[model samples]
Target: MTTSAPPNPSGEDESPAAGTSTTAATSTTRRTTTVTSKVPTVTAAPTSPTTPPATQVTTSTSAAPATEIPDAPGPLSPAARLEEVGTATVDGDELVVVAPSDTARADARQGLAALEIWLNGGDPGSTWTTFAATDPTSDGWRWAAVNRRTGAVVYIR
Candidate 1:
């Protein structure tokens, strides 16, 4: 007697036993999509020329008469011929003074020392070995040299 295999319940094709030949079926599907866009249009109306508003001028009789203003003063005179002889650094800034003679240089050094002493909250009167100008408007370093024999004094800044 001969027997055969049972049918597949999943509905899929099954291969023949051993070297037997078999055939399969294939299907294909295709689809296409399209997109559309719309742009807006703008229009402007014609413009006409416009006139400015009228202005009114009034005069006053109570104003004061104009006076001539004095001209500004000219630049200061340049310091007299001098050469750099000594320098002092204060608050990270170097202060320099020029002199024409060794005595003036010594005076400049004394002035710088006095300035440093004053900056440190000390009395600088004793440090001054020569006459120092007493100009009220002057700031920074000021030095002067006095002639011991003739009593002549020269000031340099």
Candidate 2:
């Protein structure tokens, strides 16, 4: 009796070769396993390009040229501009005051009180004196707080 095995290139199966184990020697080569990967593709949806019925978009722009604007006047401007720009800016909120001399301080307090009276819709105080006349010691140096737009004195002697 005679036996023979088939040739296997993979060498996975240890089956006897056709002429090797059965006859004299079988032939086979060692092989390593290899893996390959494949990926699927993505597709977009279909949209219809239908036309509009009759009207809608009127793309007209009415932009004017840029104009330069003027600046507004400051707060404490007595006539056109106050002589007291850098001196001090006074508002209605400020109340008590101190003067260089007691006489000036007294006159200022009286003036402020008279202003308050005027604001309250009443007659202003009567016996108020102006340092321009009474205090010649200063020799024409008189201090005052006047209204900007109307040139009305707000405080001082």
Candidate 3:
């Protein structure tokens, strides 16, 4: 009886040829695989356009009536009074006149009068006098005098 081996699973011959070298044979198999994933879809809410409120305006056609304005009044000047206080005999002479303690306004008026005279080229020596006067409008007393020869008015601060 003769015995034989089963066929090779790789489909290659197990026996070698006489007087020839033999090499090993290799085989390869390829296979394809697939993968899957699931995801959810999203939806957004819809919006409508809005409208603005209406407005009303009024217009005038006829012109307005004219009005008249009155003229403004002029400035008021203070009234001045003069009275002789004393006299000087010659140039460089001093004439002192003291104002009554109670009559500052009178003193101021006399001083102003002397100043006016000096300003008008009157001899300073003749106009020289010491006196204090107050503004008719205010209570503050001011000292003033005239130069003996030059007629320059001097005010004491």
Best by TM-score: 1
- lDDT string for model 3 (1-157, tens) is 2223344555555544422334433532223334466767677778777765576566878866443211211111233222334442224544433333332333344454564456445643454553345452342224456433333333322
Give the alpha carbon lDDT tens digit for every residue of 1-157 in model 2: 3544443455556543434343433454544455666877778878889988787877998888543221221132222221211122235444332232312322344455554555445565444322222442342223333332222332222
Off by over 4 Å in 3: 1-105, 124-127, 130-143, 146-157
Q: What are the runs in model 1 whose C-alpha is more than 4 Å off?
A: 1-77, 100-107, 125-157
Better of 2 and 3 by TM-score: 2
TM-score of model 3 relative to the true fold? 0.18
TM agreement with the true structure for every prediction: 0.30, 0.20, 0.18
lDDT of 1 by residue, 1-157 (tens): 2233344454444534523324332432222234466776666777888976687677878867543221211121254455565665556767664444432433555555655555445666743434434552352225443333322223336
Compute the lDDT of residue 54 as modeled in candidate 3.
75
Once all C-alphas are superposed, what RMSD does model 3 give against the true structure?
A: 22.5
Model 2, global lDDT: 0.38
Where does candidate 3 clash, by residue pair?
A: 108-133, 124-148, 125-148
Ten-residue stretch with the least lDDT total in model 1: 68-77
Candidates 2 and 3 compared by lDDT, better number:
3
